[model samples]
Target: MKKFPEHFLWGAATSAPQSEGHGSLNGKSPSTWDKWYEINPEKFQKNQGPEHTSNMYENYIEDAKRMNDIHMNSFRTSIAWTRLLPDGKTINPEAVTFYRNYFHELHSNGVKPIINLFHFDMPWWLMEKGGWESRESVDAFAFYAETCFELFGDLVEYWTTFNEPMVHVECGYLYGYHYPAIHDLKKAVQVAFHTIMAHTMAVKAFKAGKYSGKIGIILNVSPCYPKSHSTEDLRAAELADLLNTKSFLDPAVLGIFPQKLIECLADNQLLPKVEVQDLHLIQMNPVDFIGMNYYQPRRVQAPATVNHPAVSPADFYEHYDWPDKKINPYRGWEIYPEALYDVAMMIKDQYNNIPWFVSENGMGVADEERFMDQTGMIQDDYRIEFMIEHLQQLHKGIEAGSNCFGYHTWTFVDCWSWLNGYNNRYGFYRLDLENDQRTLKKSGIWFKELIDRNGLL
Candidate 1:
């Protein structure tokens, strides 16, 4: 049998936009997602929009109970910037009251709340202000962080500044997927730089206020594995890791950017405009810790051609599709549990063993109703196996001396995913979209036992 550390945090992660509905209610301003869905409904699958999600805004009381029932000690969710400041600057009294009550409910039910400040749900007003491409938005985000710390600082002990910010850079600026979609290398680099600057600014504010709680950032730290041991392959993998993984991790954890990454940008003429003291601020405001969201490993090979009309990461490396790779057919993600151990060791060996945790890991299955039994509960045995396999690897890393403290699944309930909506379900409790009902799935029952034992046998 293997066991995690005492006081191990066992919970699931959710986001404000994905789980909390009431997009426009209670004096809430429109978020980028709301406006994007309104303008381009056809872009979303099944014409689903962000108007009505899992309704967590109204069902938080019972949702907290569900978390406690499963012995989940810590849960991570974001505070909607749109809700907190409806107009992007003025505080909304109604939103403050609602969030106050929701955090109180979690505490009353014996679940500790881990509140994240931003989860890519930018306020519509902020978006119109040039979003991350402008430094003024960075100041706005720092102000938002300070406001959150003051408003709910007493309620939350664990605070995160941003969640998977790289996604915002890639999906919105590089790829045409997320809201405010644009494909420009210059904008992408600028967005990445401003995003990190925003994080450091938030960290500076958090430290300056002398908040009792710890503040950090959540990054999707997917390790890049080379297809072969050849020099070209290894170099390609390193570049991929530099661009995708360490670009944010180094700045947040180590208070510096990778020199190689800087050189890459300089050589390509894609360097973002930087202020004279921006690097100093980043160097001074390292996070207290970090949250890592690992779902798949990136396999890369040296690109055959480096010629391009404009600078792009694709010119440096190409994705290598390994034959016979175990994959999650539903989500189209590779299922490589060993990558968990690799990520843990990377943090231990390369990043001075910073305090971190698995913030998001789960299996998303499509049309989960097919697994429901006669009792109307989802028999998600696959999810159980997935977590167990990943946990086993994580336990190995812990025993070998990784400063990991927790393991949070991707979600607690079936929340609405971006574009995909609720088609891919990843939750311990199945949420009935029709009636806003939540039923504990088989994985939830198994997880309770695992939490009680504090180990796997």
Candidate 2:
């Protein structure tokens, strides 16, 4: 077993809307998710919504203790925008107290808290006004960022401006999976541009406040691979990469949009409206670090026919199923551990080897209870194997001088997903939703030992 660095962050990552239940309770307000679920409950699998998740809002202290028991020296979690600024303007005092105390408890327990400002749960009021499509939404997010730095910045040392910004843009605007569902290519481009601008503004705010913390953004980066050596397949893969990876990566890290991507968008009349000053802000306010969420690599093949200019990104390329590829049976995602190593190499060669971490990486399973053993604990050997293989690849990346720093799995406890809800479980600890009880799965125990030894065993 290879040992990780002494300071390597070992913990779990979770979002507020998915984990912290008690929606709109204790002076909180509705997020876009809450409103969406209310309007169309059928959109969520098993009809599970954010109203009552894992109860993390009230059970954070106990949860922090559980995290400590697992030898988690660090944790990454997001704050609910609606809970903090219910009206998108006024600060909720109760939410402030809750977060301050919750973070204090984590700190007191020898656990470092990595906080994120946005995690796809925009305040309902903000979403009602066009969400990320309007410039006003950018300013609103800046104000919220400033307030967070003032209130809880002291408790957090590592702050993230946004978590998976592309997911919100693609899912909500292009694919119509999330709230305020719209399938216009232009709106999607506009939303994505505004999101990047908001991130830059927030980064500026965090630096101007001079808080003793480092701020960055989290991106889900899945490098695109061509199915064959043909020119069409290569072009298709490059386009897929531009849409999936470089769209946010170049702006965030390089502070400039890729010329090819810009040309493509302009040719299609899908270019986002941008101001000269906005470009300056983006170029000047680059992130101090990056958090990467890796799930799987995308394999692309050339479409049979070129689509119209107004086609959504999803329609721009055809996804290829690699022949005889291993798969995650439950999630239907290709299991390619080597993609992590490829991502690390790409970062090293193209992105100046910036400091980064695997912010979210884990497998989800359906009907996980069927794996429980006689001892009343889930004997999730599959999860353990998954982690080991991925970690081995990550270790190789570090050996190759990739500057990778940490590895945080998808979640700490079983919680609600956005569209999938609790249908798929991806957690170190199992949460009995019916009883509101928490139990350690075998994978959780394995993680504790791994952390204690600071390596795989």
Candidate 3:
């Protein structure tokens, strides 16, 4: 039998914007998500916006009790910037009180809280001032992060500056899939740069404040695989890794950007305007650890023809669909359990074996009601098998000396997904949208057994 290390953190992750309803109540200002939903309700599935989420704001005490029942030792969630600092400067007392109560409840329930400062839910006020595109917004974010540390540092031990920061730049700036939808490559590069600046600044603030906690960033490090052994295909995969994986991973871990990525941006004249001091600050403040969120591997091949002026990541490499690839039919994402092992080894070999954890990993299925048994419990055996396969690979990585300390699924309960809304559910607890109630699925029960045993045979 394989055994996990002692004191491994077991839990799930959710963000405030996705799980907390009441967008504009309790002195909270609107975030970009709220404003976007108001303007384009049809963009979200079933027209379900961010208004009627899982209602965690009102049910956090019960939710924490549920987490205790599942034997979860830790949980990750983000603080809504708009909720804490409505206008980006003034503090909201009601928001602070609610968060303190929530964190205290979790602690009382034997669960540790891993607090993330930002999770793509940019404040609408900051967006009005050019969001992350402007240096002003970056400084404001650092201030907000410092405030969070000051307020909750006594209760929390782990802090993350941002959650998957690159996704916002890519989806919102380059791909038009998220809020502030625009297809501007120049703005995307600028947003990515300022985001790293904001993160390092926050890390600097944390150290200056002398907080007693480990600060880090969460990255979705999907390994890039070449479609074939040809030189062109290998080069394509390399570029994909530079853009998607190392773009943020390098700076957070090594306190610098990859040289090749810098050259690529400079050659294409897509480099953002920079101040010398910002680069110095980035070089000085490296994170203490990182969180790795992996779902699928990126399979890439050389593009048929590179654009005369490269405008997007796709200009260099195009996605390659692997033959006979296993997939999650409901979410349309390829299922590759081996990728977990690859991600683990990559962090060990290339990142100096930095301390990290599986921050988000799970399968999202649509309409889980069909799988409910007569007793009203969901017999989600498929989710159990998925977890087993991935955990086996993670165990192999740990045996090979990856410095991973924990595993966290995508979510604790069924909550709002960005544009997909509640179309796909990725949770151990089934949430009734009609009424704010949660019930554990079979996978949740199996996970408790895994936690009790500390491993699998």
Cα RMSD to the true fold for all candidates = 0.9, 1.0, 0.8
lDDT by candidate, in order shown: 0.92, 0.89, 0.92
- Name the lDDT value of residue 318 in candidate 2: 86
The CA lDDT at 80 in model 3 is 91
Candidate 1, residues 218-321, lDDT tens digits: the string is: 99988898999999999999989999988999998888999999988887888899999999999999988889998998999999888543466788899999
Candidate 2 residues lying further than 4 Å off, grouped into runs, are: none
Per-residue CA lDDT of model 2 for 20-41, tens digit only, reads 8989698889888898899999
TM-score preference between candidates 2 and 3, better one: 3
Off by over 4 Å in 1: 308-310
lDDT of 2: 0.89
Query: Candidate 3, after superposition: displacement of residue 21 in Å?
Result: 1.2
Task: Give the winner by lDDT: 1 or 2.
Answer: 1
Global fold similarity of model 3 (TM-score): 0.99
Ranking by TM-score: 3, 1, 2
The global Cα lDDT (0 to 1) of model 1 is 0.92
Candidate 2: residue 223 Cα off by (Å): 1.2
